[model samples]
Target: MKDRHWRTRYRVGAYEVWGTSLDSEERRRNAPHAEPADFGLYLDERWHGEEDARTSHFVYWPTLEAPVERALLIARIKEAAAALRDGATVEVACFGGHGRTGTVLCCLDVILRGTTAREALERIRREYCRYAVGSAGLENFLLNDTGDLVTPEPLRAGEGR
Candidate 1:
């Protein structure tokens, strides 16, 4: 329906992550993935649609508002990362696919790669998009939450424990 904000998939080891925006959903059901992913990992700050709910194992947050819940966000990221390792597809997205989308993608990178937050941010910008993690506040938050290298623990579907 409009210009696409879908981006190339970033891979770490055996898993892959794709970043997208709300507008991109209208034009492609699964342009970035073949035959619709086994599942999705929706990362929109304030947007979730029927398709996402029905087909994705999603996590929601409002990136422009209150800070993201660090523990919960980490759990979700771990879950998605684990799913990816298990041969499932995960698509992380936000309204513009710039800030929140990119931030979460970097988080995934950290968990998967065991890199520092700063390093992940740099990698996201270099390999994904320059506009990624679009706010100083968000950047700071990520740095704080993931200052220590994060090693994501695998989480099962519907299990946040």
Candidate 2:
């Protein structure tokens, strides 16, 4: 809500992914799909305002530290995917939707769609837009050979799988 400059939406697999560019009002107006159940992922700590919240399809806040943790990120994406499959529009946003948000988006692509982290990051930039992840550290993190892309195993609340 704080004057989103650039916003664009596009389909990624079975989900729609996008973010505001920066200081572009026009993009914000026509950005998100006009659905009530959309889910948004806010990367930054800034307040996006009450009106933005009310009108948003759905929103998720994952306040990550400077270097994002893989386990936490995977959990958040799982949550987002669940929401999206349940008839909600989803948005993942950081300050510029580049560094933090972009990194997470890449992870989501690999984890959900079976792309390698490196390949997924590259695909995100090539397909979504350049300047997606601004930090070299974040880019490295996404592409690191950190085992078999650790993801949360499905948990049954009251019973064993």
The C-alpha RMSD of each candidate to the native structure, in angstroms, is: 6.7, 5.9
lDDT of the candidates, in the order given: 0.68, 0.58
What's the number of clashes in each of the models?
A: 0, 14
Give the local distance difference test score of model 2.
Answer: 0.58
Best by TM-score: 1
What count of clashes does model 1 give?
A: 0
Q: Write the per-residue lDDT of candidate 1 for residues 1-161, one digit (tens) a residue.
A: 32346645877655778677767764366553544555565666345553342257555566643245666667777777888788777777677777777778888888787777888899888887788887887787778766443645689889886
Which regions of candidate 1 deviate over 4 angstroms? 1-4, 25-34, 50-55, 147-161
Which model scores highest in lDDT? 1
lDDT of 1: 0.68
TM-score attained by model 2: 0.67
TM-score of 1: 0.75
Weakest ten-residue segment in model 2 by summed lDDT: 50-59
